[model samples]
Target: MEITAEEMKKSIEKIYERLDEVSPVDFDCGKLCGEVCCKDLEGEGELALYLLPGEELMYEESDEFELYYIDSSEIKYPHSWKGQIYLVKCVNPPRCDRSIRPIQCRTFPLIPHITKNGEFHLIFDETEFPYECPIVRDHIKLNHDFLKVTYEIWMKLITNPLVYDLIDMDSRMRDNRKTNYEIVV
Candidate 1:
């Protein structure tokens, strides 16, 4: 699955533009009153690691590893690979293929909200095994430069006009509307 240089460039450009949008905004990750969510069990399910469309193209082309999406549905990853992955370390996620990682990864630790008419907003989802995510806790401090940059990058990616275009394409592909268990890759 060789990728065209132009497409690769487009991916990098889009990602760079997005990276500049999601600035890491320092915020509190609520204490875990019970079991350590991410620590003990590095949560499974797509919601735990959703990847929007087109994000997989690069990964597929690169052949770094194989992890399929639930379907072409944007952001609806019902179940992703949950192999014996280690947690409890200062581990940065697998180095995302600069051109392949999903927009969600670009906007990590932050959730995207789109209105019915099609307006995007950046919202944080700190409900997961957050206590286990050091970045969500003391590791990433408020007003930190990196976090600020991440916050901005996420903001722009959500508000970027192209989001609608992507959504429109997704809608067309999703017309059939039947649940697809197999990922496109």
Candidate 2:
């Protein structure tokens, strides 16, 4: 069954609260990478992040972010995903309200992975970006608490079938390609 908007909102809020103080490093890692992850690539390309199913409930039309929707058929989303997919871009990069950052931002660097054998693991996100993230490129050790809480949050998230399908689809693609990744947990 699809998760109701109310359920999704509560889950997202709890996730935000849990991740409020946890970060990949003790200090702001953004300083090291010049906040490349948050840069507003105005003319380069659309610098946007995809919102998880029902995550749009947490956002509204605002000056802080430009929100747009794409039909799932137009993207590489899992077949189970239908309807519109929400994408958001910050108007002012690296300066938006950190507390309300999307789950993609909150879980950056480490992506949740489910193995062919059904093993859940956390690995450095290997998605190519226009700029390099120092933390991922340098193999910097993430804070223990950050990893732990992120893992916990993902575990809870995947309980929703839609989230599970998305993660599993990505995992299967990685397996099919024999992609090598460093497992953090």
TM-score of each: 0.43, 0.93
Give per-residue CA lDDT, model 1, range 60-130, as digits (tens): 44543344543334443222323222111111333334344445555555444444455444444344343
Error of 1 at 45 (Å): 7.5
Worst 10 residues of 1 by lDDT: 82-91
The candidate 2 region of ten consecutive residues with least summed lDDT is 54-63
Q: What is the lDDT of every predicted structure here?
A: 0.42, 0.87
TM-score of 2: 0.93
> lDDT by residue for model 2 over 28-77, one digit each (tens)?
88889788889865567968889887777777746687778999999999
